[model samples]
Target: MPSAEAPAAAAMDGEQRLHPWSWLFVLLQQLRQFVLPLVALLVFGGGGGREAQWQALAAAIAMVVLVAVSLLQFFTYRYRVGADGVTIRSGWLQRNLREIPFNRIHNVTLHQSLLHRVFGVAEVRLESAGGNKPEAQMRVLGLAAAQALEDVIRHGGSDRAGRTPDAAEPADVPLLALDTADVLRLGFISNRGMIVVAVAFSALWQIFPERVASRWVEQHAQQLLGYATSMHLGVLSTVAAVGSLITFGLLLTRVLSMLLALTQFHGFRLHEQPQRLTVERGLLARLRTSVSRRRIQSWTLQEGWLQRCLRRRNLRIDTAVAETGNRSDARALKELAPIATPDACDALIQHLLPHAQWPMPAWSPLSASMRWRLLLPTVLVLLVLSVPAWLQAGPWGLCIWLWLPWAIYGAWQQTRRAGYAVDTALVAVRGGWWARYWRFAEIDKLQALRLSHSPLDRRCGTASLWLDTAGASNMQPPLRIRFMPEVQAQALYRQLSAALAARRLRW
Candidate 1:
């Protein structure tokens, strides 16, 4: 029988073929990509008749083709491990060859689903800087082989200090670890429950027949109306009943969110290595990924109202690796401390950026007119919307103006909370009232800087400054300071630009 390191040895000597079951994983992955359409077809394609027979025949043919393609790919794909790099060759007809140097690979990721674990196999992805896709991806390999490959690449494709690739080493220094209780806290503090609910609702809507949905709604509506008529419930009672139902729904969502957190973050741990940081997490589906210490481009500290109440905060990092377009892959690298105390967060930041002072003593406030500038858009929006409200509800519609006080209060809070801080080593922005964040990057890591003035800003004598960093996420707010004095904005931009020009980017 072949040993666990057999695959690694084979690759080092010549070329290696993936595990025998690689085709199954490839097939499952492809199927997952088109699951929604497949669900729709399965739900709606079974109407009886000659048309149904044709649909069934076509589906069978498609499945057979998918299976054949997966098999073909597994047979054709081949990779070799070399002293300086790795080489991959694939495609029987087209034929492609590629080589990736160990020094250029920025991210090394391993994923193991429950099935993969049961089969003692794992998936590996090697990502390079400034590419939209992974440099190389192996669908399935022996767990030991995967780790050995990671070790070889991390040590510049050579054994470390004359030891074998699979030799055990000193214990890793622990940076952070999450237990079940911490994961539960994170779930309660996250809004991922709502996202999960929305996705589940979409799936149900796609799968359920229109008639079934209509019937379910009709039955519930009739039942509610009959109960109300029979009880002759007062207005207050009706309101209480609706409120109770909403409360129950909210509790259910929280429970679901907790389950999600457990699945995604159970057994989470962060470890500090010689030149890289490693993250290991997940319950049934595991992930192990590493990023070089110097590859970190920026950092963010996020604290929501709930997190503050729980005395927890989230610390994330941005790296120079190109966007993978996979949320799971992004999460593997970004989440350094999913949930940690304020002190722990500070310690982590200090350890990573020892020169850049963590938790600067004071922050420079934005422009004096920042409050009104923020409120101007809200006022105009309310005014425009009130017209429709008046058209429909008469005097009651005018109550929409009641929202103005709340908007004004929010603007005031935002203005007070938002500020920027800078030093020779770092530039940072802090903002957001209810859900607050601190975003910062080293001076050398900044890619670009912009100073802009809107029409209103010009009239108000205010401007905004924006800083660009590598691998920024579209979902997160930019590192910006809005409604600052024009002079201050210009000075900050020039200072950062000068700093960027003077130092070389580490990543």
Candidate 2:
């Protein structure tokens, strides 16, 4: 039998079709993308039993067509990695061939779905600069084959340090590995549950037939009110009931969040080479992505109220080029450390970027004027709305006043969290109350810096600072330090300029 490395080298030079098992992957991919439309066609097709029968028949035909198409795609798609670069030939009707040169090839990502994992194959994606999509994607290949191809494309060899990937003596070292506890923290730290909820609600809305909108909402509201009224609830009882429901909803949402976290971050591991960081994660769909450490544009350290209470933080990395040149790829590549204790984060950052500070020192507050700027408007609006509410609902209207304090408290907390710091090598900013984040960009990656005061800020003699970089993490809002003392903003801007001028630009 040929040795593992030999086959890898040969595979790199030779054109090949996707692994046979890819048909299943292709089919699943199609079904997942179009399942909603198919569902809608059946649910709202509106022909009663006859229509249902026709819809079923149509769905069956569609499935057959999809299966056949997947088979054709698997057969037609061919890829090769060579000294020149990577080339792909796909499409059944009009041949669509793509060739990406090695230098132009931005990155190679390896992902494995549950189905692919079962078959011992992984997906390989090749990305190029300046696009929202990958240049080429191989839905299924043997895990070894994927790594081997990546090796040839990246290192110009079929093995690492003269050792085949299957060999045990590769030079790459493990940087970090999340244990069960750390993974659990990720579930709590993740705010993706809201996004999931929004998507689920969107699907549900699509599933609901159109004409039922007004009647359905009214009917459900009446039923809920009737049930609540039937209970003859007093203020305390109503409060308790509502509180219980709210708690349950929150718990359910958290549980959903936890599930997503587990599915996405299972068995997460990080490894480092001299020039790149490689991350491998997931249970259902495993993914391995590598990025050059130097390409990182910025770092974000985030802490929500829950994460803060738990003493945990999330670290995200922003890179110049999108990993696979798409949103999904961005999600997979940006998470530097999903959730870790502060100590672990410190270790990770020190190891990852030695010169960059994690929890910075000598932070300058955004200025106290921000407090009144945030609070005054809210107070005025509350007062404006409260009088009419009081007129209509009497005592119930006065109850709205209770929210004023909560709003003020939130605004105050934001002001407290707002700050900025500049060091010789980094420019950092802090904000966000419920979902607090600290973002710092390397002076080397600094693209542009601007300082502007809003009309409100002008009256208060405060300005907002915005810094631009090659790329910023989605989880981290754009670099905007709002409501800082105008002079401080200008000072930071100048400091950043000097620092940037002195350093070799990374981008």
Candidate 3:
């Protein structure tokens, strides 16, 4: 077998070799220039009896013309690699030149489809730091060549060691690399995709009647019925079995869909460089993403039931700076690495913030009064459910009563999961129960800081501190550190305020 380093070396040598069909690929991408408007014209033109025939003929011609132009362009485009940077020069009528410096390059991702794999060619994506768009992608490179190019960009190309801009690499950095097992663990732990599929299923069911949908449902009902009957039995066995089977079938379908979606990142790996961290993964479409330590504004750790059982966690590092150039062109940069163990996550955090403090002073828990205050939502829900039950005069009243215990339990769990810790330099907020998350932010990143007390909170001797950060509105519990004893909340607010007030404080 070829050594791992062979791929990197081969890529460097292959960069100068251009694929004959590269230009055709470029043209295919730009074929929309003519085909789209032509499509519009054909659809709305010829308003008489000949309209249908004309539209059909026009559509066929348009498709052929588009394919022909795309093929032409794909064959013509080519690129070359040099000592300083990679250069791409293409375009038939309006030639273009793009040179990307090795030092500025942040990530090099390789994507291979079945077709590309057969041809031994892969798409190489180049992402640069400190750029508005951050990424430039091109196809036609051999697979080995693509991986080699990635290695050069990641390790800083051989010629770039002493002469490259920003050549000074940070020392003593910790890099975490995920194995195949970790990828599988992450696949099972992720439920976001499952949740999405479930919601979509629910929406479709609501929009269409069950009778109309039952045909498809019934077709697969036997498989579900078998699974349910194997696991459960009861007095109303047949009816209960049917209902349970349907529910399990829906859940099983969602889980399978989620697993399929996660397979995209099946072979994930994290490479920690001296100055940055790089994540590379994909099943069909590979992606390489890197983030500089200096640019990471905040870090969040999340764990759900499966993750907790597996002792794994997901890490999300948020950067204040946006890859704006790519945004205008509608490109997405990779973010979020799932299923890192707690120790691995902690190490990554420490690597990003070497000198920062750890496990800051745990804030005092919420007062007993505050715990009672958390029950208000459950009380309101119970009352709402009771009203309809009382009017119906049926077993519905008992059904409402059955839900109260679960509601109270959920409230208690939420209260237990909420807490905060503050140190001179950082603040950590913990939230969620089944899906627990820990968010860490430096004191300096606060856009706004406040100590707030609701009328009920004040009476209960509890308060909450809201710390807002730029570009973090998407975060859950956007306002962190909710529901604490008033004194503790006030003290934390004062400490954070003082840190912000002092110009000497650094993140």
Candidate 4:
């Protein structure tokens, strides 16, 4: 007697269920809390001591009691999906109810651990653009069910006519996904060496005093020669051996810490949806970040040494949002999550501004003056490095010699890749070597534009135009397009000013 549409709707509703794996997680948590304390107590208690045995038993019993209470509390927790929002009910002593509206949900991420994968289940994390933590999370759910929920929210659910919601109609935006090639490109261009150096330096700071003392003792050993002859050989040798062991331990710890941090962030993925970009990464404690399109202020493309070899580039997007806010401000908030890859970045921007033109122009090479201007920074850095080396190694200290060619090459490549093109509504700039980047911005969104000339640049008849946007307030020099003809720079500035002025009037 029921209609065909009615049965289909019922089937969709039936697919939504509580994740079965929640029970396993609760059980594991309870076991860890109860068992670990008992094991610790037994390990530390002295054998055949009546007082220690009694004390250990009392601690273990207390831990078990606390864990039992927690398990009871967890059993009462439950969640349900409804027409307007998701409802969560929990707490044994005081029942709590919370609702999360569909519109407020930024992105739903399905995470699968090895255990979950084997069991064919996944955890669902609901992220909001405004919140400091997950807006809502369900620990276990069927993979199909999770996907269905994501689809429903992404498409705004079903209509009264019983037709499934159209995913493309509301935003008509294209989703951007990065391939493996893009991920490799991002990893190569990233400052992996710099990250490792920073981690190693921080670790060294923690153990520096001990290291310095040991080094001083070793270097001044001849000063202690008089004392060493009278001291027991065994004691002196033991002290030397312990110092060596400590130094080795410190070095190993620093290396491991750096490796862990670097490897964790190696493979990154930036997935673009209609309204937001989701950044998922890390080998441990995987991070899922949602960045809304409306919050983005500006974008940049970068390419470095390794990226050039792979013919790839990195893209960074800057968003506008206050990093600190109130608790309620935690519920939904704006974020600036940078994504890598120029092509994917361009796709995202084009979705946001479909009318804009791209790949505008590839002009002549960098002028002689521009090349020299870029080289000046390399020269300054070399001078700074040389001062210390010269003081330590005298006139023969050529340790800094190794960096000169690399610095010069980097400067040359940077100048060569720096170029810009302007159309009626959009402006594009291309730069970087290992990871090539092409940044596009609407002329209307540009807050300010200026043509700048250094004494060196002026003498060579070259100019650079800097573009500022509402986003990326912290960026140095904001938006810079280096090495341009003076005439072209002035013309581009005029056109951008006019477009921005028109946008203001319309708004």
Candidate 5:
């Protein structure tokens, strides 16, 4: 296979074609989208007598249509490198054509699934600066061709016209490497352990009856918590038993998280180039992506209560490009460090933004009066709940009132965590209570500025400021500061305004 970056020979056509195996990828994808319905119909056909034949025929027709569609897709799809941009043309009826210029290409992800690896083909997903969908997705390209295409999109490809592709350059440097041990560590701290349990439980239910496990868990819960025990159980003993169960559950989750992490980041590598950063990881569905430094909109560091206890942090980068339809882009690009020590996390920040230094944020803390506003909302909810409780059991109904003190403590903790600061390089915000988090973005990347004031805020002489940017997703934080002192909020707004006006926007 010829590299897409090289100048094509006169005998060879400039237009590129996918591997013959792309037809299989298309068929598998199409089948996946309709497998559930197909199975349901087949089951229904088995249950019914005369109607079974018609149902089976309908399912067969659906399968044939799906296969035909995939075949047509493979036949019609075409992609080629041009002087101005990379072009992708597809669709027989709608006839969709997409061309993405070099500057518009924000990021490129090269992925290979189990089948893709077997066929020596890759999926090249190109994400642009602005859009909901991906710029183009070349589902099956040769490994070398995909690499060359990604490189051509990133750097200037026009200069390589009428020439062969070059080998690895000296500018590339190995920045980070994650071993099996590191991946195992990442799994424990990932905080995403329920997926496995849920899938397993669902599969069990589908295979057997729901009561198979649910009843057993209920019976065990009764036995362990003293409901069915012969010995007398005091309140403290019951509480301790429940707490122990919770601790065991948390430990199980951590173990599961670690196992899942090992699967996702089995062989992770971070590479640094002159203008771009590349990441390669995974054992099953491999991911290889490059994100340009110029497209980075912001950086965020998060520490959950469990993570905080372990002195671990999750770091993510917010880029200008779209997220490629699903979280594959986020899973690959947003995560700068999935799991690392605080010092290692700080080092990653420095490595990513070498021009910027970590300055002490001069925070304007939220005022004490802000608690009154926070408490009011909770008070109304308590009042509404108390009405129903009073109707049921008079004096005992007010027991829900005990939750007030806990709620107040939570609100106070939030007040302590809430603050905003701005420095020469980044704007910072600290918020959240049990799971406190800090969000930071570069000062020059401000997209929009908004100052909001309520009647209470006006009376308290405070306001809220929102900092909008292009890089917003589930992975990154919303850059908004609530309940800031009016004078300080206005001052920061003015500074950010000046910063925005002075520099040209990137996205």
Candidate 6:
């Protein structure tokens, strides 16, 4: 129970083993990965009487085997904290040693669940650029030891620096803090609850017996119909009932989303240190992570219609932290600002990228004929869709043509709002109509620039410019400017290429 400094100092010398209880955590981690299969086994494999008892015993044996394996791992895993980096050696039958340099580490994450906190232990993960998995994962370390290790890595642990692990450093500058209100706004703006529901439904479909599920649904449907018949309900009453049910479902999802937000960002705080940025959050499970400021590769400012109406926006960044096999890595590294006012978001940008000039005055519009170019595709799609509707409904199907006006409006609005901005330090593209976003990157971060013209674009005398950055997320919109005049697109591409050539890529 010593301070973080004590463990850090201790770790700096010879090789060290994990906390004694590390196996417990390792067991739990393994269980989590196979939880579904285990549950299915318990429910389906276990028959009544002796069969159930035998199945239960088998499951217990499996758990005991897992525990034994975890213990073996704990006994085998050893790490050494040196001046330059940490060397991890692990294996039972076959020995494996990995040396992770501090300078190459892109992300240092510490996680503590409720149980881990009770045990005064934490899990540590180290990630580097372009790696498919975490460079190192320490299952259980003393809370202090984990922080000390994180601090050492953050401060550059090379031997030549001759730096003390516990040396006092610059105070963390407050960047952004989320209050209950901010979390609520984020919950309302996000569709996480719906996603959770969909996932739950999918899981049930996979795990639940189809006959049982169908029987339950049939019983409920029959009861509802009987009740309606007894009440002599008309179409209006049925419609009202359905409307109420839909409203309730929506409310339930929103409430779930809010609860999720509360747990995830209960005490979310982003802070800036001398060399890196740090974030700490969560209610039941605490997460603390840091990424070097220079490691950020691209920035995104997003505002859906809901966010816009709520007067909030989400600011995200792509970091050099590689996309890892761990799903949680994406959630941890992507969000820079989950929810904030426009002005606050801009302030954060200004503080982080002082050279780039946070708020570019005005974005240059795309080609004047961009609307026509956009509309052409919409017209073709609608024409195809209208045929189906007309075939089905005959005269009534012609009403599908009415959708053209909305499509036209959408195309025009998108063209009007979509544009690109360039300055000495940054290149940004703005796009989307209802769900708008701005993607920008420092000129130096440009990995590649492509200027290409489609057949349609060529006929329209326009081109598209694609910008690529390291570690960019495919889920997010790309930094691409479409329907720009061919000459301007080519010029911008050349300018960005020159910028990339002149600078050394930092990340």
| lDDT, candidate 1, 1-507, per-residue tens | 011123244445678888899999999988887788777887776678998889889878988999999999999999888878889999989999999988888888888999999898899988877787788889988787788788777666656335575666556788999999999999998878989999887777767877887888799999988988899889999999889999999988999899999998999989877678888998898888888888888889999999999999999888887676776465447899999999999999998788889998679988657999999888889889989999999989999889899999999999999999998788899999999999988888888888889998898788998887777744276778899988888888787878888888766
Better of 3 and 5 by lDDT: 5
Per-residue alpha-carbon lDDT of model 4 for 87-162, expressed as tens digits? Answer: 6777778888877777666555666555666676656767554444666666666666655565555544443225
lDDT of each: 0.84, 0.76, 0.63, 0.58, 0.76, 0.84
TM-score ranking from best candidate downward: 1, 6, 5, 2, 3, 4
Between candidates 2 and 6, the one scoring higher on TM-score is 6
Worst 10 residues of 5 by lDDT: 1-10
Which has the greatest TM-score?
Answer: 1
Using TM-score as the yardstick, the better of models 2 and 3 is 2
How high is the lDDT of residue 137 in model 2? 77
Q: Tens-digit lDDT track for model 5 on 1-507?
A: 112243332322377887777778878876876765555445433567777778778877987887788778888898877766778889999998887787788788888888888888898888877687778777787776777677666664543453344543446677677888778877876676877788777765554445666887788888865653666767898789779889999899989888778767877877777688888888787888888888888777788887888888777778886555564555447676777777887887787778777633378787876676677678889999999999999999999989899889988888988887777777888888877777878877778899999887887687889887785644445778887779878988898899889887765
lDDT (Cα, 0-100) at 83 in candidate 3: 67
The residue-by-residue lDDT of candidate 3 on 228-343, one tens digit each, is 67876776987776688788976676566456645556666666665667665666655555555544556788888878888888787655444453322222233455667788
lDDT of 1: 0.84
lDDT per residue for candidate 2 within 202-286, as digits (tens), equals 7777777756655787899999999999989999999999999998987787778788888888888877865678788886777
So what's the TM-score on candidate 4? 0.54
Error of 1 at 209 (Å): 3.7
For every model in order, what is the number of clashing pairs? 0, 0, 19, 14, 2, 0
Candidate with more favorable, higher TM-score: 3 or 5? 5
Q: Give the TM-score of candidate 6.
A: 0.93
Tens digit per residue, CA lDDT, model 6, 97-208: 9999988998888888889989999899898888778899899998877877887788787332575645566687889999998898788778889999999987886676
Q: What is the TM-score of each predicted model, taking all chains together?
A: 0.93, 0.83, 0.67, 0.54, 0.87, 0.93
Mark the regions of model 1 whose C-alpha exceeds 4 Å error after superposition: 1-11, 160-170, 327-331, 473-475
